[model samples]
Target: MPRLRANDIEQDKIARFERIKKAITALEKQQKQILKQGDLAPEGAWVARYQVSQNRKKYWYYKLQVPTPSLPCATSSKLSKYKHLGKAGTQEHIDAVMSVFRRSVWDEIQRIIHTLDDCLLDISSGSEQEEEEAQD
Candidate 1:
């Protein structure tokens, strides 16, 4: 009977390491994007969609929507509707919020990636051990 080959296990470990590295790089890239969001407003704003009748023609209009827990934002209005941005300002509101959203996303991803560091190190050490054993 043939003994099990370490090469197969080494390859598998190498593949896993490569995957982890890719994930780390991707997370770094995402964090960079968040950093590039420029200055962010302290107030959190959102746009809500509603139907309006314009000369008997129906059209959708957007306004700064109410803040939700998901966004966790601050607004200029303590407890009032947002009209400071004005009508047709949905795009502006969303753009303003991207910084906050990106920051949260980046933070969450980094937190998750931090937990994988130990696993990465273990994989690396195991791979080296397997390679050395195979060479013997």
Candidate 2:
């Protein structure tokens, strides 16, 4: 069997770490949006999609469309509709939902990080042993 170089293993581990970090950041942003606007409002926000092409490479991006009152003239109807908007439910309910979503994502990230840590430790230990054998 061929022995793996320490640098090679470390580079792979670092790349995995960076990818996990990016996922965590994205999740956190989603969680914040839910918390700030209340679950229903943000859920109803329209999604705008666009594609950009540069140097033969294409990338897609999405942004939330701001919601405006559909019945601008019906002041009473508008008030009644949005009356339950922020006051639809208790803060506890919103927090509970966000908590569940955040926890599940966080747990997955933690599991991946733990697995990568073990792999890094094993690689370091193996490299140390190899160095000792080379010296002997």
Candidate 3:
């Protein structure tokens, strides 16, 4: 097996750091566009539900992606935090769907950016440590 040299390792780290920085910049731009599109809409998912009772009723609701804090004495399930959108064919319903989609896309972009940021930090710190060792 061929052993890797210290110079080869340093080059690899620099390459990785550059790639991560590029990815983070792209993700930040996408996030900004998504935010601009969703500026007027509240972030949540549009949900449709059915009931066995009341003549098999169908309902539409908007459930927040992140649940809000509840009162100390409140005995509510996570599922109970939905806000009724009422009637799925309305313009409001369409807007709600768009809002949900925008929020989901934004969240995914943010997640990628965060993970890349961590990797970039790790690579930066590793390079710094190597430099210090080389100076000793």
Query: By TM-score, who's the top model here?
Result: 3
Best by lDDT: 3
lDDT of each residue in 72-94, candidate 1, tens digit only: 33554245544333345466656
Tell me how candidate 1 scores on lDDT: 0.63
The list of candidate 3 runs beyond 4 A from truth reads 1-4, 40-46, 50-66, 69-82, 127-136
TM-score for each candidate, following the candidate numbering: 0.46, 0.31, 0.62
lDDT of 3 by residue, 16-112 (tens): 8998899889899988888788542344444454333356765444333225432122344544445545465666566666777887788889889
- Candidate 2: where are CA atoms >4 Å away? 1-89, 127-136
Query: Which digits, one per residue and each the tens of the lDDT, describe model 2 over residues 1-136?
Result: 8877989777876676676567656666765665565343332334345577899998665433335543123345342212121222456435434544555555555566666556556555654345444563
Ranking by lDDT: 3, 1, 2
Candidate number with the higher lDDT (2 or 3):
3
- Let me know the TM-score candidate 1 reaches against the reference structure: 0.46
User: Clash number for every model?
Assistant: 3, 0, 0
